[model samples]
Target: MTTLKEPVLTKRIPTHPWGDPTDRKVVSYKQYVKTDGYKGLKNALAMEPSDVVDLVKAAEVRGRGGAGFPAGMKWSFLPPEDGGRRYLAINSDESEPGTFKDRLLIDFDPHIIIEGIAICMHACRLDTAYFYIRGEYHHQREVFEAAIKEAYENKIFGKGSKLGQINGRDPDLFLHRGAGAYVCGEETALLESLEGKRGWPRIKPPFPAVAGAFGRPTIINNVETLAICTPILERGEDGPKWFQSMGTQRPEGAPPHVPASFGPKLFGVSGHVNRPGVYEEELGITLKDLIEGLCQGMLNGKKYKSAIPGGISTGVLGPDEYDVRLDFDITKYDTLGLGTAGVIVMDEDTCMVGVARNIAHFFGHESCGQCTPCREGTNWMSKMLSRIEAGDGTTRDLDLLLEIAGSMGALPSGRGATICGLADGANWAVRTIVNKFWDEFEAKVSKQRFVSLSVVGS
Candidate 1:
């Protein structure tokens, strides 16, 4: 597929292959305007709210938060204009490991995100907004808070705002800092946290769109997901077609229900890469080109062994899977999804068992303790992986790890599993690692640091 002609999202932020990151600095409201900020919101305001939603739907802007849900389709899900207190919660909870893509925008170009928030509020008629930021982002919270302050002063929000009262309420935004709980990164949990309750995923049927945030309609969007709306809105009517022009078309016979991975995406490269950082590129860029070209190849010239295509949750991309395209359709290769597009690259010497152990530990620790399978299964897998890593595990332990990883987070139809679907990151992360690196896992189980598998797919 053809690559992006120029950075759309990072145009002002100064990402690599285009501009120097060293020259980056926090953009003020004035600088943001000079750089063409808020224009999208202005355009959005001029159109009917439904028309604005239609434009985004036409563009098919998928969620950057991880789930690849189309933003406009999500907007359309709201149960009509009840003229009550609808809400918009901007998710800046960048808790996913290796995923610093959202942080990059919030750090430097806060207005772009702020403007996107405004446009979304106007489009969806969401009157009140909450920027549910990561509690650990102390500095980013300050920066974003200051930006919101500037927006208020400049009449971007508050009563008599440029967009006027939305849904019979003044358009307003607030920053709600999270308590650093990874579970809070889940949208419902974020809502619960925003509402001064424990951060735990709520069961569906009462999805946030219908009854979110204090029993009212709500829209939760990621910072990057909203940030991308700026460029699309700026381009006006050509936005959708412009967006569709860049990314790869969905593979033939693809599920009609599945959304297309059109438009550019921000890929955060971490781990053993020479130039590790966030780089905005077309959705279909190959993992090999991303590493060898933009990342400047593996660290210390060591050969690349594997990579987690989009955060640990999406699972590992084997050395042979380097040419795999980074897109929503990547699940065809057996990943959960193109999760947050945070790639964690691994070098040849890296221990697969150790990687799996660490991932299992993280997910096990982060489970909200609400789902029995997620709570227990992750811990069991973690303990098993640890035992195997400690060279005290037998072949039975290895088989058990696979079985637990496979069965974990499964619904009631398959016993011993319960998760919010959004909470199944660990299930995929640990399972994919052991499956792809079976030889390594089997070897480690044999008290060998690196041994070939004694049996295939055992």
Candidate 2:
């Protein structure tokens, strides 16, 4: 089994295979400082902020928030510090089902992320940061809040802090609870929710880097994304090269600018795996190795049926695709981009139609109803799946399911822009399931009273 030379982000937090699970516990501020926790921040303080940004860019730290965008480039996107109150929005609203990696960090190693937040704010000159955690994280809210208090106590923020003033303001971080809407997980929608408005996506080009969070320059990053900055900076000059050495290298002939899936990622494996839990592994680890090695094979020795490469949003990997690598390049297998890397494994006894049905229903309910294609398309897919799962579907229902999913206005070929990625996720998810399990869906539909039906005029 492949393993990192040693744990980086999961160093303090115990994860499977690498460390004994029973040894896990919350690391307090005192414990954190003693273990060289804030050393990364100290390293940053000794260097110019632009140099830090350049260092992270050199490391090619990809956003661990599923999108996998480079953190350094994102930091550079900010308009020059004009003595304005630039903002940082840490997306801790990890509401996506099967995605629990962020929660694990908040539950135990909150200080690492706190340190990361400080480094990012310092580097980007973002004076204020809002940690937008999902409301469902009731206990986690308290845990993280207490951690932030620890940082304040240690002068991580507030007046007289180690960071001092940047862009005419003392660096500060605040915790903002979400209203438990899934759509608010989107960057623009989260910004809107933070503004005390409905959680709906905003039009882009004013992309958060330019104007966000109360209409100022803003930067949004996921919890894991920010947490990783700690290690990169801690290593100082050697950090970037050290990071690139672990994960799969750039494709043989790919351009230098094309981002490689570098660094370790926290994959929350759930569903039918025997050892269903989060594990930290370098990018490009094969799904087969993950399931067989870290996950300890399927539960009860059942065969693997399917698995979601990341969250339900990224779509499923068929049994034949077990060897597919888990990384940003996962889309080459036809699923959506590797999302949060929150994998959901299904066993042989599991029903594929029901899987698609549950996923469609979730998206349908969670959709904010702002975009017509996503709203109508997702709801239709849900109803059709329910019918198919119940054996009340016709041959035409299967075709229409694919058609509606494909036409969901998520991309250029569809109706129009989906505002946020809800439609894209929903479409790719259902479409991948149907395409991969065509035989299963067809058999279920064949049991119906009608084999074929003409479209009814609307």
Candidate 3:
């Protein structure tokens, strides 16, 4: 028999989520800061914002959210000078179905995230920071609140910290708890919630970069984004040097937009997998490796069928695509998107249609109902998916689903009744069912009808 250790994602993983052996756990926020938490800030405060931004750019710290937007450029969007109470809001609302990675960061090492947020504040010349954690993550909420209070009491944050002199003044930090709305996971809506208003998506002209969190420039980041900042600061020049050493390298002219090196993506792999735990690995780690190696293979000897990469919003991929490298180049896949980096597996017993319906129903229920298309389209999609899954659908129902998904996914501007991700999520469910399990759907519906008639005759 042979034994092997699971692979490491990137150098930053252990320092961020796994906790540093040399450092203390986030027992208290005061403990975290007293234990040298704000190193990122200390490092950045000595450097110019542009210099700090350049280091982040060199390190390739992209958005942890599905979009993978370049973090340095986003920070550069902040106006120079005081910018009047500019804010750094951490998007700790980790409600995306199948995504549970952020919960660990919040609960396990709150200081790393706090330190990261402070570094971001330095980069943007802003002092105020907000950790907009999810309401239902009560454990994390409690943990983070304690850490924030401790940080405040110890003077690691606000009023007297090193950040106070960014423009010759100190700024405060705000820790807000969001009432569990999935839409609040969106940055602008999260800001709205923080402002004591209904969580609704705001238009981007005034992108959050321009006007946000009570009309001040804002930069919202995911938990992992902030957590990684601690290590990035600790390693200094060696930090980026270490990052370039992992995953597949991008040769010049291969793709103009793709970054040259792969980085870490923390994934929470659940459902049907044998291990069923969160694992951090390189960006381009194959799904097969994720399932067999990290997840310890499938459960109950069941054969794998499909997966929802990232989260529920990410489109479904059949078993064949499992070997495809999981990276940002997912633009080619029909039903896949670079979502929350959550891997949810399903075996053959898993009805793709049922799975689609379950995900669609969640999005429909979570829709804020502010937009007509998203509010109504998600409901219709969920209802139709439910009918199909219950074996009450016709062959024409498949066409109806396709039409509905098309309108929701790429609705004509202002003409069709669809807008934002709620509609897109609904559309993803409908599209995945139609494309991936057309045969299963057709068989189930016809079998149900035949069984119904036979029962009637008997």
Candidate 4:
């Protein structure tokens, strides 16, 4: 991978507020109070509800989930409060392959998420919120549940609690567990699951903003997005500026006022790297820096092959493309994508065909089976890739794989075919691997054919 000229590293501001390097214990309520844990909540409660919304908008906080939607804009989309129920659903279902930042946040800093929920509830005039955690995260769920208990016990919630009463109403927060399904990570699908229905994504028009969670107006955010609220509220206007300053500037000719993919990002780096773990870094840090600088380069000193910059759903970037900035806007061009910032690296010795097959298998199994293109495409592609990997593929299989991937709504076709992004993800993995590593796939086929000819002569 090519390296870029290093930008001057700015003073590293603490992004993980509740994280203590010296100790790994969960932050107790008393310890949290000492560090001004609820300061954002207190400040939010003092502000007019609309002003709180404006404050978040001015800060320009983008959703930390793969979509990168603006947090404040999503809140503003809610219909005017009608003296009825509105909801804030925090998506803790971190099921994206190669992603684990949310799990860490919930385990180490549960109180931060809670405080963020309180602040957002005040901003949106929401009196009820749900913390939808994945069922597999039993330990994280216990940590968060204990924190919730502590908050309520300390009068942070319940009747007559100052933190409970925001905007003249006592807000209620519920921690709901999700059955382990990748589809529930989608906000609308999550609502369906929350409402006691099967976890299938709803079609657009009346987006979750207009009607969600039992047919009421709703706003949903990922765990990291909500956790970020604490720091943003704590610093007020300065928070957004600090965040905006951290990332690379938006390229010219882009939308005139679109914010850069600003703020600190937790990159869940895995696969063939010296340090296969999550590392927090400023957004727009080059792939070269992330791998060479943070991860100490490829494991056992192996040369780089390719990488999946986001989760498995994003297309692969070869070593040559590593110079590209890891920003959402920049990645939108070409075959590149920045989904969830989960960097899965591959070394020179890795088999691209096997990798593609594995990713295809995952999406195939995880598909909700609602959309025809995704439901059928993923399974077909997986089967074909497996055949290719196992030396049973004909020469025609390569083109067939490409054809199936494009039909499944890979880029240029855009996101219209599938009910959700899962299909696109499967397409991306196959398309990129075949296109970028054609030599490897072709070599496998040629070797198999040569072996067959030798056997026939014998």
Best by TM-score: 2
* Worst ten in a row by lDDT for model 3: 1-10
Runs off by more than 4 Å, candidate 3: 1-37, 250-254, 409-419, 447-458
lDDT (Cα, tens digit) per residue for candidate 1, span 1-458: 22689888888888888999999999999999998888898888888989999999998889999889999999999998877999999998999999999988988999999999999999998999999999899999999999999999999999779989998878999998888898888888889899999998888768899999999999999999999998889888888999999888878887877778889899999999999999999998999999999999999999999999887777888878989989988987878889899999999999999999999999888888998767887888888788888987777777777676777664332243664753367777887888899998778666644434553334
List where candidate 2 sits over 4 angstroms from the true fold: 413-416, 449-458
For residue 394, model 4's alpha carbon misses the true position, in angstroms, by 2.0
Descending-lDDT candidate ranking? 2, 1, 4, 3
Error of 1 at 388 (Å): 0.7
Off by over 4 Å in 1: 410-416, 447-458
Better of 1 and 3 by TM-score: 1
Superposition TM-score, candidate 1 onto the true structure: 0.95
Q: Residue 65 in model 3: shift from native, Å?
A: 1.7
Better of 2 and 4 by TM-score: 2
TM-scores, all models, native as reference: 0.95, 0.97, 0.88, 0.91
TM-score of 3: 0.88
Model 4 whole-model lDDT (C-alpha atoms): 0.79
Point to the candidate with the largest lDDT.
2
Indicate the TM-score of model 4.
0.91
Query: Tens digits of per-residue lDDT for model 2 on 228-298?
Result: 88998899999899889888877779887879888988989999988888899999999999999999999
The CA lDDT of each predicted structure is 0.87, 0.89, 0.72, 0.79
- Residue 432, model 1: lDDT of 80
